[model samples]
Target: MERVEPKTADDAGARADAYAAGPLLNCLIREVAEPRPDQDGRRVYRLPGGGRLLRVRAGRRPAEPEVYAAGGWRRVDHAELVKLVSDELRRHTGRANDELPAEMIDSRETLAALLAARDAATAPDDPYLRSEQCLVTGHPCHPAPKARGGGPAASWLPYAPEAHARFPLALLGVRADAVVEEGDTSALDALGEAPPGYRLLPAHPWQLDLAAPALAAAFADGRLIRLGATRHDVRPTAAIRTVHAPAPGGDVFLKFSLDVRITNDVRRLWRHDLLRLRRTDAAAAAAVAAADGPAAWLSDRGYRTAAFAFEHLAVVVRDGLREHLRPGATALLAAALAEGFDGNPLDALSGPAVWWPAYLRQVAPPALGAFADHGVVLEAHLQNSLIAVDADGMPVQALFRDAEGVKLLPEVSRSAGLLPEVSRSAGWERLVYCLLVNHLCEIAGALTERFPAYDPWPAVRAELARCPLPEIGDLLTSPTLPGKTNLLLRWTGADGAAARYLPLPNPLAGG
Candidate 1:
């Protein structure tokens, strides 16, 4: 698809505002507001906390927000919307937050910069790469999905996936004795050669810049030595920290620590998570292996880092698509499918009758089966999942990654010392949120956007009913599904891993 350029600064700002407002509005509507009857062909809602009425032109992406003021509705631009949200949230939660409003503004500014950068830069030719880089409005429910830690645009634009950025990784050599590593990290040795006394560890260039101050001591003491950059350019994936590196031998993905907060937390590969990577990855891999069909797990094979600056300099080697993906199938990010992009397979579908079921067949079974049979709760959210489509643009396989988010029931229950019922309930809630609410809900919404009269949930219900898990019965009968409260979580300064969910009307029920 050809890039559309805004004619002026005002146009860019307006476009950015509309883009930024969608998720913010989604959060506000879902979390803080109570629904009111539609007014003037627009959906209306009551902001109970602020005791005001809000309305917006509604669809998957809500827009053109207006709030009742002085006697009539007044248009709420991005800034005003942020203010309205902050005020309503403060009253609703009885908690004041200064950080989130700034993030909301920062997210809009970041989008404006991304829009300009995307227009100027050429999009990647590879469909997979295109899909990976195409999320302009990320995490449709997130309050500040694009916020880059309130950093200047110039600092992050070069590394932004939305900008279709590709650059060589900064090669760092750690003294062999100072190297801390686990799992199959032999891939690092191939990226670049290290001196006899050191081992090579690839670092994201932006991370190197962010951690420069802390790393100075290591550099001075010869614990770390710069070996320059790699020969090949690595494309930044949707997860800014992870990069796809093309190689003659085999393609690989290198996930590194990025200090900047993208969505909820600083996107760092924390030491605690890294320490348990092997066990989590093994369970997920085994679960995927046990499931029937072409479902695959893009294993976080291993990691390597400097002992001195572990979290800051650590890099994770993830299994590439070529090995896990079906031979002739093209892998596309599920988020890209929802977000729309050039060459998106969903765009070409004439109808969802056959396509929707086929899509669900490939995507749903692995996640549900993994949870029910193997006791593995996969974080099968849109961003972590990839749908591999055959030559005809029909989904054939599903690939899931990111072991950091996987939860094994036995381990989780044991560690938390919870009753079986409680552990199961927690796991099911998490799985439901990630797999259905976060992943499928977005894709189904995107499909419905194209085919307005098409109700996509019956097919989803059918797919769910096919799963023999007992949770399926309750899921289909339940009135609500767990929707993660990202805005409140961030507003309350809760840990990113400490997920909090509110009930959302479950479409899969009683259809």
Candidate 2:
């Protein structure tokens, strides 16, 4: 939020002028509403006209709001009050002052600078190690030992027998207290001499608060080796201890949460079942059943579940292509496809194509069958998908995340059938919008922009053929679009050319 500071009276006047011309011109400040306590245990004022933007702590400092006109004590509009309060409060209570060098602003720049600085400061010959620890249990590698009662043998236990057999402890977050007077330096040296990937990072000061109980338990149980200077301070949010697995060319990203929650699809499975039940225990039972598949899969595969069982689970990091792709790419791509093809592939293409029959024979029917049988709502509109290429720059896979958006088959709905009063019309319409417009358009747009030489429309057509998607031409030619977002296609074969257009209501839209 930092900007070039106003240097002179002229500069200040210019900034003031600019502010008036900005979006805040029409906004009015109604009044300063009474203070209300917030989640962070701080009292904040709700300014009437400025929406629900909560005010920050003003404290003993007489912070003044920037007034538009030079009026001594007049009623201020909401927008002006917001600007004033923000500036004054920010001045009184500074934000986290962790400013990097001016040049390291963007993600790429920050990454590059941090990498260089870390390389220069550390041992020239040593490898880089990043470690994290969970706060719930004090163990350096979390899902703490207490949380994983099976002791060291538990799947998620950092030092599981399987780990010791293959993956050497390359990077370790030595508990600050674990390093005693004997000096933890020698142990570091021992690790350094072991292998190429072997390296260690000092635990942050806040890690002590995290690992305190674990250290105490280890000490009482004779598991901890007392060394010199065993403890360092650590902040709660910033606390973590990490140990690296001994492996080459590994790009694993691990996330540890203080709260135990099943994440992603796993959580969805439980949630869906919870909504099925009328009572709490029945809901709990359903959730347990939902977790069975994943838990059993992990157990059978020997993929260690950390000692501290978390409600949420993290996935192993892959190529991370989706990280760079912006949202809405998919929606754009779909719209592009719809525009390119005049609905009928046969009519749109002038060239004789043999693959069209193959598409009809092999792909379309089966895709539709799979969706119906598996109750899978592909919702393959643009935003939910990514167009990633391999080293050769050929699109290889479509990575799908965000399972929350995926709706189950209607058959799976409760006996009540998706809630008696559920806004089915609105919900269905939004689904259509999400699939046809938002998701598809963004992706197709990006794809076309990137690969002009390659026409991706054919591929989309093939996909549509595979699913029992109504022919685009038929949908456009027919009069009615069943949903508000124009997502549903009603087919009419009788009239040949002239079809009607009707709108459908969004299922989720409030009537």
TM-score of each: 0.96, 0.30
Model 2 ranges off by over 4 Å: 1-309, 312-373, 378-396, 401-407, 410-438, 445-466, 470-511
Best by lDDT, which number?
1
Cα displacement (Å) at residue 282, model 1: 0.6
Query: For candidate 2, lDDT tens digit of each residue in 341-390?
Result: 11212223333233323322322232233233433343344323323323
lDDT of 2 at 256: 24
Model 1 lDDT at residue 369 = 93
Tell me the tens digit of each residue's lDDT in model 1 across 409-508: 8654354343232277899999999999999999898888889899999999999999999889999999999999999999999988889999999998
